[model samples]
Target: MKKFQVVVKCSLGIHARPAAQIAQACSNLRAAVTLETDHETAQGNNVLEILNLHAAKGATVTVTVDGPDEEEAAQKIQAVFEAMGPKEKKVPVLKVAFFGTKDYDRLY
Candidate 1:
């Protein structure tokens, strides 16, 4: 399993759109993805489950990817979160830092 933690930079947190995007990122992957907050754990491919995480700004989220395509799946999901940048009018400030991984750096 591949595991990493990130802070939610989006002002509004993981709402419908972000959740949908996260779900979409995992839709075609052969690996299983999961996101976890302090109080809840959610399936990365489930919009409702992601929304249920209720991760607000600055909330730390742990992402886990396992199975056949973990590397590809992880990269895809990371891109989705990275795309939620300052340019995104709907949900600006969305970014993440992959904790403990040399390949990732903090966005903010």
Candidate 2:
């Protein structure tokens, strides 16, 4: 088994999009992959399991690969994490209106 650690830098964390990409990548590989974050461990090929991790941005995650293509799997996953930019705080967009106020307008 081969093990390595990587930090999740995607602004959205390990949400659906990233999880799907990861799962697909793992599915295409021959190695068995596992991802660990906090007390949670997920199969790399399982998108739902990966999403359940809810790995916040900037969290350091451990990736373990075992089987014939361990090295390649590790490298590919590492590259994916590295490609995502550093964690960022997401800004919330809100719209408010005052009752009976004709001048009310949406704020950008």
Best by TM-score: 1
Cα lDDT, model 1, residue 39: 99
State each candidate's clash count.
0, 0
Give per-residue CA lDDT, model 2, range 22-107, as digits (tens).
89889999899999999899999999999888898889899999999888898888877776666457989999756553545433
Q: How much lDDT does each candidate structure score? A: 0.87, 0.87
User: Lowest-lDDT window of 10 residues in candidate 1?
Assistant: 99-108
TM-score of 1: 0.78
> Which residue runs of candidate 1 sit more than 4 Å off their true CA positions?
88-108
